[model samples]
Target: MDWGLVGILLLMGAGGGFAAGLLGIGGGMVLVPFITMIFTAKGFPPQVVVHMAIATSLATIMFTSLSSVRAHHKHGAVQWRIVALLAPGIVVGSWIGPWIGKQMNTSALSLLFAAFVTFSALQMILNKKPAPGRELPGTPGMFAAGGVIGVVAGLVGAGGGFISVPFMTWCNVRIHQAVATSAALGFPIALSGTLSNIYFGWSEPGLPQYSLGFIYTPALAVIVAASVTMAPLGARTAHKMDVVSLKRAFAVVLFGLAAYMFYHAFA
Candidate 1:
């Protein structure tokens, strides 16, 4: 592997992982576009470049989520009950997402991803709270919500935190608990999504070397190494910082990324 490529991957991973821990995100919002650009520069076929970037981002999330969850768990912030309720539907929905994504046009998928990112960023900027008396739904409702979160996350290669955290908070869960629980949910989302991507793309042609299905293994390896190490530090930072301000700052960054992605889709 080119050392320069490795360096870039490591940098992306570190940034993504830190965001994951700090914002209760899986970091795919950051990873997907950057990785797509890197793969494009490497001359990968445009049709498959986004797919590969999403797949690799999901794969990396498996590790980053684990690391972030561990940190959250240490603080007794994770709500395991919610995770248990969400896992079944999340797995099924995640499995189906890649199959659907594989049939979409590359530019369409990129635009969709950009839109999702922009929406999530706006949510952070607004920081809206739900009704004071709201509460979590029963098992069936939680499962359905998980399904929606999983499908969207799988398509975007995210950890589902953007959706999950908000959903939990709307149900009157505390912000820290919602964030922690969302970190735990990332495990199932990433795992199921990665597996589906691997299966769906197993027969695709023109994938780059060192790839396993849609996942680019070299980038995955380098990114995972840096991300896992940095996740705990981010979690620690999250505990100490003013998350609301941090989120607004992150929203500005997301807006920039969204603009870039929009240009890429149309230009």
Candidate 2:
């Protein structure tokens, strides 16, 4: 292992996990872009770099979600009912996401990732609220929403919070509950996306050593270790801090990340 890369991954995990806690994003929104930069700078091939970055970033969510949810649950912030209603669709949609990714080339995947990140940034910056009397839909509608969330999240390596939080809040869920619930939802997203990406990329060539399909194991291990340590702290901070300014600052950072991904798409 390159010790230097490991140190950087550690820092990435610390930042990603905190973001996951603060933003309920499962760290993927932060991890994907940074991992791509790391891999790209090392001269990795585009196919392996983009796919592995997404896969490894997603794999870390399994641990971060658990840590984050524990903190949220301690505060009675998780909405379990909604999690149950959304899960079946999420699993099915997540299973298909990596297959769709497999069919796309490096450029297309990069562009898609960029678009998703840009949308997320804009959504954060806008911070719109839903109309009064707007409520969560019926079971069928929840499933449909879950399907869309799962597919997009799996494709982009997010925890689905970018979409799910606003959605839950729009339906009149409390912000704290929405964040907690989104953290809980991360487990399912991570499990299905990680498995599917592994399966889809299993036979691909040119992957580096210490890799499991698309996941770079060293990065995954270090990131998970570091992220898990920070997620709970982030969760605690969420309940105690007023983060409006922080959110805007983070949104600005996301725009920069999106720009990098866009440049990468055509590079």
- The root-mean-square deviation over C-alpha atoms between each candidate and the true structure, in angstroms, is 1.0, 1.2
lDDT digits (tens) for residues 1-267 of candidate 1: 799989999999999999999888999999999999999999998998889999999999899999998999999999999899999989988988888899987898889899999998998899875654778899899889999999999999999888898789888889888888988999999999999999999899999888898999989999999999998888888888788988899899999888878988886
Which parts of model 1 are misplaced by more than 4 Å?
none
| Decoy 2 TM-score against native | 0.97
Q: Once superposed on the true structure, which residue ranges of model 2 sit more than 4 Å away at CA?
A: none
Reference-based TM-score of each model: 0.98, 0.97
Best by TM-score: 1
lDDT of 2 at 260: 87
* TM-score quality measure for candidate 1: 0.98
| Model 2 C-alpha lDDT per residue in residues 117-225, reported as the tens digit of each score | 8888887788765543578899999999999888988888989998898889888998889989999999998899999998988889888877888888888998998
